[model samples]
Target: MLREYYKFLGNRLIDWSQTIAIQAGDRYVLNFENDDQVRQFMSVLSEFNGIHNFYLMTERSGPNALAFDIDPDSHMQLVVVSTVEVTPDYLVNLRNRIGQQQGVWENTALLFVSNKVLDSINSGAKDIGRQGGPFNTGALKRNVQATVDKSEKLSKDDKDVLKFMVKTIYDGEQELTLMDFADVYGIIEKGELSDSDYIQMGYFQDQDLATYSSKEERLAENHADYVNISLAHGFGDVRSRITKIVDGEKLISDLSGNNWQSVNYKQILAGKERLKQNKKISLVYDAEIMQGINEDMLIWDHPKGTSKAGQRTRYIIVFNDKHQNKLTVKFPFDATVQDKWITQSKINHKHYTVGTHKNQLVVDFSDLKTNEPESVKVRYRHHDIGSLGFTFNILILPFTDNKILGLRPYYRVKVKGEKKANLEIPSDMDELILGSGIQSNKLNVDKTSQLDNLMLGPNDQLKADLSQLSLDDDNESFTVTLGSVPLNFNVFDNDDNKIQPRVL
Candidate 1:
């Protein structure tokens, strides 16, 4: 009875056998004596994981050979007889080759699929759905007919198969079967396909299956790798043009030809960021200093008076005999000297005109009477009027002699009711006397005169008799009398002249 049942089951399996072809390299004949065979075949399908394994299995088993397994529950029953057609090893190699080529085939496949869909819609194929079963023969036929009706560029047969393939593999509208891919291979072998068509079909299948709204946008995204590789290789003209655009040397409209459409969007965006950083660095190094004296040395005309705290005093000596004293004052770029004049009325001043020598201001002081003291205030303005400004004061003294006195020493003293005052003496005079009047204590007539202390008020007057005080050639000493009680006052020489004055 069991033998008879096995025979019956084998007959049923042969009757139920069917040839299935889903894609180019995947074709198999599935036979099942019963439902048990189908279950057994599905259980081991995962073991055939790669095309290499599938190829080896097909080669070992002849075209009509049946692969069977025993059912454990019913040890006598033949489980399965599955036969797959021989898939060429070259197909596996071709898949690997396409993968190595990266996005080349994927982009081509996309273009071909897009073209077919467009052609189908243009031919008034209204019933063609966007998605359907993996092997929708009706949709495939409509796509093929649409291409044929729209253009006569390709043969009807070639258009039919290529359109079917691109839709199956790229658009995922249908399953890509081994037989269909094999048909592609046959078409390629006959050289029936165009160069562009073969190039598109030869590339690897893209798993993403992403879609784009426009052809230009698709090209920019898909062909970015190709464009970059081309630029890297030797497309100097395109690279130069792109570089010019990135550097702001050229505009987008100046890209020339359709090269702009092919440019990688990511690279352009990155280039713009680099340009922004470069501009920031450029501003740091090349920024303008707003037309004024920004440096303290330039403003004060001395390295010592660089502090911004208070005004400084500068002394100028001019000879009485109409000898011109040229003072060269340096200022920042674009600064103008507005007006300079002496404040004293008794001195005869020259009508001075400010002149520039090597971008420095030159002021001349002349035509002044001897022993007539004057104060000159120079008012200058910068290019930017909104910025803060400073005032500089000059004490001008006219002397009778033309000898180079070499910077005479002056003593700064604080007087009553006056903040500060300077007392300057002749360099040749070694002895100085101070009193209410010149007493008769002279060894020689002209050298025995008394020198007034020039006190600011009677409250702080010095009533002491003639007292000789010696000062070093390079050092300063001070004497102060507060109602006949003399106190030591603070003084400074040229080395430490920046010390602030203390109250007496």
Candidate 2:
């Protein structure tokens, strides 16, 4: 079973051996060193029909050793080199192969390193735990804290000045974070701070003599000054956008008519609304508008036996300047559209001017000081006749030249009468790379592919490339029909399976 499970995994599988000393009821460890033997040893665990009588556990024994155990009440352990990199691809394949067991198995453990450590490994930061250099701010702060805490009794003002002086030192021309205090506390508890590191500390201490001030006064002054700096740095606009979203002053446009089943349509719309309201959700600001459906193009087939009722699917596109409204953006011509009116809710009384210019949708909200975030909905009938299968393209465009991260695309389809529709996203489509500065492959979902987080520039364009849909034929007419559920902004929380914001 193990061999077959890994048959498609290819070169990632290594070589191994089973210990000869096996006792009664004792599981053996399949020790791996090379490629061929590991392949042969894995064959011992194969059960062929995707059914396994046993399960596996992964362990990180050392910096170089990785191992897996198949304690099936009938089997053994498979140990491999610790030196192999624990890559994102490796983690994904391992999860898929483990096959979730029946009920919770407490003994089974999943071992992996944090992304920071993985990044360090990739960047060749091999010194492990060296300090005192420009990069070791944690160590520097610890030294400074020790010097301040052990010094002869000083005035409250002097201590505050010392602390601030140390902060400015380790912060190195950048903004200081809360962790500076936390790390100092950690070092103090561990007794890692000492007098030798106090030489430079004394210099900063002497410098503090001229700057001594009460903490309250310094914080108050800094707070007021930083507010202005933040505004100059774009926080003002962000605050405005967030205020609108939180107050629900924004408009939520929805359309429902034509062949769409009411229940399914409502459910899909509800999901989108939830996503939009999710507080943790992060949106790509300055999204580049792309060519969507060309006006009233024909898409989707009608129910087999019904008359040709045209397609009038709804489309809702949301825009938000995550940087808080510091950025202003005009509606992409593709979204500034005029078509059938369904419903528009100016819930918060947020005024908007919408119209069409030169055959494209045109919307203006600049007068309101809102730009980064915008949501538009338009419903229109497609001119094409119905068909069994359909193909469409999903375009991704970024509006700014800055490196944009975490841009993913998701889609949901609903049928009027059917509770669940069979949908498939083919693997043949071109691949997309997400941001995060890593080349991890995008996740493959229920038939569709994840719009993997992408790093795009103002002029860059990434396409879901193509979407091929095959809907289940309606039993009544034996015809396959397709419907669109405007892309909802909601994401599901993995822990409770409840709808929640996509936490960044």
Candidate 3:
């Protein structure tokens, strides 16, 4: 019976096309035909020398025949031959039970007749194999493909780590240090070098620089060659600025316009390092140009509007010095006295006092660091009546030099209540009537003379005489310019309804 069992577990099963192969670190169950087949399997298992953690059951509903571990220490491979046609559900339960055994078994094989059992076993194992499994060329290829498919939705940093891991695995490296893992994974602990530090150190070898004779020439050549590479791997903010410099959209100089030179690769590298160290400060603000104003000045709005008080706008200002600098925001002299201004720093929770200095409302920011952005929220209410607008200035005073850096012009205008009216010019009518209902006929305007004299010079101003028309609650007047001609008319709304006129 033992000889028959040995043959059934080996060449006999192979010849009969009943052999089963299983990967290590997985579980399987063998279903026998009857008690006789189970007894034969037991006899074969007993003949094995090093099969440890053996468990034998008398009578059970499922796979209760025998269980044992087979690994290097056991000096044997486990094989179970059975002829019984078991259900897929029963085989799954048996597999789970075997997996719960005390010790892990290596190289387990199951021979059974049911196609359902075969299907269940194939679907039960995870596509990715467990760690420390016996390596097979086909399995390795499948695992690598599986890893690639799984990495589709991973983040860029995670994909980077996976790339390093894949390269290491492909190179068959057996050992890895913690520092190596940290570097690949981009984990900057207390003592480790930052990503910027690694980039600044330069990855090119000395052998790569053998062509250059002088040190300055070598550095210049290296900088030129490394620009593209560093731009590709640099930090997010650094990449954008470097791109702007490369595209000639921005200058590569300090705020004071000093160190003005063509784009240098070393300067960009140093900038990346400085960014990492929080040596640069950025101030974000929102500004827009007035529609009617022809000047190129942008009107700066309050940091937060009345409706969107929670939203923030970011502005950037780069400095040349490494030490902390004081920035003073000066408001218009009239606006300082007529407006109630409240200022707060969003980043460091620092309190800013709006005080008058040199006939202007000035808010000073001292000891500003670059580690985190310092955003100041300015909320103000204008109390003055008939106020036009005002211009504010941002001046940065660096301790290293007496030069003051004037960033930009920050102008703000008072909110006004006004309505837009559109007028239509008729081809046949020499005079047009303006107003609502029967009262509309009271005001009439002739545009033939105005149209003839519409020629305007650069500093010319065309004004209409409206001294005879009394504009009160009963009458309203507005002027519409056609080409360059100004036509004035009065409108009366009997029902006090607002009118929107459009030019046809």
Computed on alpha carbons, the lDDT of every model, listed in order, comes to 0.32, 0.30, 0.34
- Candidate 1: tens digits of C-alpha lDDT, residues 164-281: 4554444545554213433343343333454344334432122221343333343333344344434543564664445433433332333333544443344445455655554443
Instruction: Encode model 2's per-residue lDDT on 1-504: one tens digit a residue.
Output: 233223322121221122233222221122233445344434432423332333233443323323445454644433222213455555444334333422322333232222233332223222212342222335544566565576455444545545664565565556443233333333233333332222223221122223534554543333333233234335435533323222222211111112111112223334335534553432121123322332212112111111222112312222332322222222232222333322333212133444445334333333223222233222221111111111111111112212222222222222222122222121322332222223233333322223322333333433333224222233111111111111212121123222234456
Error of 1 at 366 (Å): 5.0
- Give TM per candidate: 0.21, 0.18, 0.19
- Measured with C-alpha atoms, the lDDT of residue 240 in candidate 3 is 45
Model 1 vs truth, CA RMSD: 26.6
Highest lDDT scorer: 3
RMSD of each: 26.6, 30.1, 23.5
Candidate 2 lowest-lDDT run of ten: 475-484
Off by over 4 Å in 2: 1-351, 356-361, 366-373, 379-433, 439-504
- Against the true structure, whose TM-score is highest? 1
